[model samples]
Target: MSAMNAPLDLPLHAATLNPFIAQAWRERITPALVDYIAIPAKSPMFDADWQAHGLIDRVVRDAATWVESRKVPGLTLEVLRLESRTPVLFFEVEATQSVPTGAQAPTILIYGHLDKQPEFSGWRADLGPWTPKIDAGKLYGRGGADDGYAIYAAVSAIEAVKAQGALHPRIVGLIETCEESGSFDLPIYLEALRPRLGEVSLVVCLDSGAGNYDQLWLTTSLRGNVTGTLKVEVLTEGVHSGDGSGLVPSSFRVLRQVLDRLEDARSGHLLPGAFHCEIPVERIDQAKVAAQALGESVWKNYPWACGADGGLTLPVSDDPVELLLNRTWRPTLSITGVDGIPPLAQAGNVLRPFTAFKLSLRLPPLIEGHEAAVKLKTLLEDNAPYNARVTFEPDGRVGAWGASGWNAPTLAPWLERAMDAASRQHFGAPLGYIGQGGTIPLMNLLQQGFPQAQMMVCGVLGPKSNAHGPNEFLHLDYAERLTASVAQVIAAHP
Candidate 1:
């Protein structure tokens, strides 16, 4: 039978989420959501002079006003301040009626970042990243899918559940500004607001995604991040290549030699001691399922060069499980930037005095960030050929995170059921569980602070959403369904 004609044996309590919340989401939430996403709250990473550029403040105020207007009977909203001039907006929506003396309702903490990656000006017709637009049933905007819409979706879901006289969990939305820059200031904000946050039972992070809109992706693992600056000094100043070629060792050559020790060019395996970790069996199963869903088209979806001379070779593992495991459960390294080099223009042949590079290392779940940083520095220093003076400066780092509760038997099945219901009603497929390589440090932090909380990371950015790129967008239909799914989960929580 076709999905549209299929019967839905939804949970009795979750039925309220179907026609009522879904229709309300499409009518009341979608249009205003597009306008909310148009604001350009570019992260501090892209805009160093963020304070001077007051767009972030404007966006924060906008969010505060929206939340204040929708204030539930017992909920209160607060705009918080963090160190380094960072701003965080917190929404504390309490249960209207109290539980019995010993019985407590499960509190779900929803997390999202309001800031956006920079948007450079070039886009297809009627489709700019900052100018929100809806086309072919897709909501196109910079922060729409990545996170701005998440705040609205979370609150709307709670409202929908409450409006139906169903059981509504106490929800707190912790929205921050510096997530794109590795959440440098979040620790301070969390500490300052500890009392208000209280104890959380579940964390619903709407900041990750799947390979596509065809299925739901629950991120079970995250790769750690280690970024540092590697500097090599060969001479006090630049000298003519003809005079310095043989006499002085080139810093660039020395740096390249040091990098060669880290990864194998053919196999892409990190050298021994680069990282160590274990992959769980369930994640392996999830990867296999993801591969089956992707088919051979997975490789083609990746951004790759067209020709052999200038293109990346395909990964050796044809099985989707191996591919996904490698991405989420293993450590990898990339040279992100190079410094102390003159442009090709106005060039004379000269041997540079020094060269430096920005190196980024993705850590496995078992590795510690500071420990990895120390090992990386020692390796770089020891491997430098010809005793070339080298120094390593740590930039920023976030440790890897694996889900704390794989078998939250109650929560997992409920999410799966809710997502499945939404998919059948909208797209007609079972939701997919997956893992992401990127780091979301807040998930780990929240889990640590509230050890009992069942954390679930899900979101709307699908394949080719192009977040952090020129033409970023959020899929409209998927987003609407996602909102309804959230409502279903809130309603179904026992």
Candidate 2:
């Protein structure tokens, strides 16, 4: 039935939705989410044998089974597989009634990922990567928050809205399994399914972060990424450190010099005229608002441990606004992993022949990942100190994204009211907006395809959620409220 013809008395306020969504999650969604988290559906990057392991396939089946059990009216579910590519779970909840040919009923697209990051070390012993544990309202495991709850949340919202006797626009769910691998297969699947994806008016993405668990956080922009291995080779073989100390240049030192070309050693600032773009005035204003709302939590929320035994403490800028800007709008470099180094116990007093460092660079929203990767490779390879052998091999380049021409006059007011109601009712706080210091490569593709649509990115990854790291978790109460917020927006979509 057309939403235009739905009954006007349907309850969409917090009084009705809060309890309804909460009950749905308690009775239906939570159990399934826990089960989903137990499956080790590691992304292709981490598990090159994902296809052979069948973990991705198992996740697709799991989501399909849960969605089917919900028995959402007019729902059609399918796992779309392109040859040799990761699966895309495509499901649609149809509108109840038909309208005139010239009329337009908004089609809202929901995007999320079922794949997960590798199990980083340091998980609390009680919480294993694939072991599901619920303690004090937090679901602890991999993928639960970094976004395993997304498909369940999306379907639950539709069911809750319909149960309230209100109708939503046509809702389409696109859950992919290659997101953690930089979504390389997404563009292919998207192009193949372009014809079926109708005129989209809004896009809801539940794959971002919140400042805290107290209120809903909307992502205004997402940083981009370039990942690769930087290697420096100085000698054909290792020699005693005492013999080579005077004649040989340490590969580790050469690596440091090459990295200095990209970022300053003292300030950690990216070199000028490298991979940077001017920050828009609007983003700066949004950063101020987010900083005010987040306060000290902006820095304190991180799980930083003070160095024990006369070690250093975390050093962050005192100004939260500058910290937020540096995180979301500026470039940063981190050496995630290193090779060719022996453990302390096994190390001999020898100069290493080669050193390989895994480089993970986060770029501003407007910088292109491919361009950044090229520039970095050139910078490292062109001027090798002592003409040593240097090779920069990029593993992947994931582009950054922002909401371009992101005016959503109709959906904006509804979202504001919905978030306000949901936040106050659930957390006794108000909703806030901020830019995330991460990348969701799929969003750039969706924005490029549906430039005219309103895109709202929000999720359950809040402070201490530790997504992409050890001790990852999903705040159960927050996920429940976020589902209701989604339901409210769906019911109110124009």
Candidate 3:
């Protein structure tokens, strides 16, 4: 029978799903994940000498090696590379067209990334960023949670479908290695492989966030990013504070002055007109639905640091709905890193020569990130406070993306039913929808490329997963169910 009318005995049932993929994770993917996390495969932005370091190559090689060992019936996996750019592990899994209905199947594209964020500070003492530690069913390490499990998870889902004797479309997997670096090199590879990639009926992305671990989380939208460096220089060399305190201005003060033009100092609200946009009615309605499902956890689920006063509170409104809107529909700025600042232990009474800050700004779904970057540059450089040498250098920018999730008539209901079935079978709860505050540059590109294709963005990064922060982890049980859910959707696809 065709997949449309096939029995729902596709091995994703609670009885078979957990035991099958759980054992697979234990015997195969977990060990591989441990090794995957051991490598410091920091993105190109963090490791400027990424090619020389070879960590990115090592990750691609290891994952490719694992895929080769699978030896799927008609699988072809290769590390597709562009000149001087990071490699993308491409896998083409031929479809098994043996259903009784004998209907033609559609082509599917599954996208993921292998590159990882840099090791930020504050990991628990016993758990280092590269140290693979498994505790109480959670795997503690980098990349494994943020997305190192993707390739293995995708292949496992396909395998689950095959084992059930279910029919699925031809699978094209694009696992890039530069997603964490704003995906600058992705367009080149996408253009080159356009012919082979062809038109896709559906796109499955396993690189997004989850609202909670109890149920499947569908990412309905993703915020865009505009990141750059802001540098303020007051003097060519350091001078004793006593000598320069009155004679010259502190670079830190000048930096603050420049930032004031971008955002309100107290409220943390964006002040620039280019960064603001009216909230869409559809998104506002979805946010209310999501808020009801998420409830208090909308703010409570964050892994606040210890003793940050009962916990870190929101800089804006306390209402969960407003917080959700602030995160996804509003623009926000964060100074991720600073240079020319010495450790507190090495205190000096000298005025520093310059202060440079790495700024990461999240744009609303309707805002244009590149144009905002230009506006930001002009705002900071137009009037140099105290005639300081101030410069704003933008690294890269990508616009936010919103999917027609509820409006995907052909596949939305089918996937939702499959997702609900998988969730109830595994976790006893229904699937939920939430907007992701993070940025995924590829989603916008793919949505533009395949406007007719339905997109389902889901992942295992749930509460306190701390993707880019310290103590990152992956919930093993949730991942198993998630993989099964993916298989269920693939098997049920028309």
Judged by lDDT, which candidate is best? 2
C-alpha RMSD by candidate, in order: 4.2, 4.2, 4.0
**Candidate 3: TM-score?**
0.92
Question: Which digits, one per residue and each the tens of the lDDT, describe model 1 over residues 216-275?
Answer: 566776777777888999899999999989989999888888877787867778885647
Clashes of each: 0, 3, 0
Candidate 1 stretches with Cα past 4 Å from truth are 1-38, 71-73, 102-105, 120-129, 309-317, 397-426
| CA RMSD (A), model 3 | 4.0
Error of 2 at 80 (Å): 1.1
After superposing candidate 3, which stretches have Cα over 4 Å from the reference?
1-14, 98-105, 305-315, 397-411
Best by TM-score: 2
Q: In candidate 2, what are the lDDT values of residues 1-494, reduced to their tens digit?
A: 22223233324866877788888889888888889889999999899998999999999998999899889888999999899899999998897566679986678999999999998899997998899999999999999998888999999899888887886778888999988878888888889988778888889999998988878787888888888899999999999999998799999999999998888988888995766778888778878988888898888877767688655456558899999989888888899999989999999999999999999888888877777777788888997999999998887534421111121222355555655555555676766778888888877778788877887789988888999899999999989878987887787776
**How well is each residue in 1-494 modelled by candidate 3, as lDDT tens digits?**
32223234433455665677788898999999999999999999889999999999999999999989987777898898888999999988787774356554567889888899988999999998899999999999989987989999999888877777777878899999989888888888989988788668888999998888888777877788888889999989999998889789999999998999989989889997778778777677778887888888887876655565775755357787899889887888999989999999986999899999999888887666677677778899997989899998888533421111121113355666666666666676766777788888778778777787888888988888899999999999899888888888888777
Using all chains and alpha carbons, the TM-scores for the candidates as numbered come to 0.87, 0.93, 0.92
Pick the winner on TM-score between candidates 2 and 3.
Answer: 2
The lDDT, on a scale of 0 to 1, for candidate 1 is 0.73
Q: CA lDDT of 183 in candidate 1?
A: 79
Q: Which ten residues in a row have the lowest lDDT in candidate 1?
A: 401-410
| Model 3 weakest 10-residue run by lDDT | 400-409
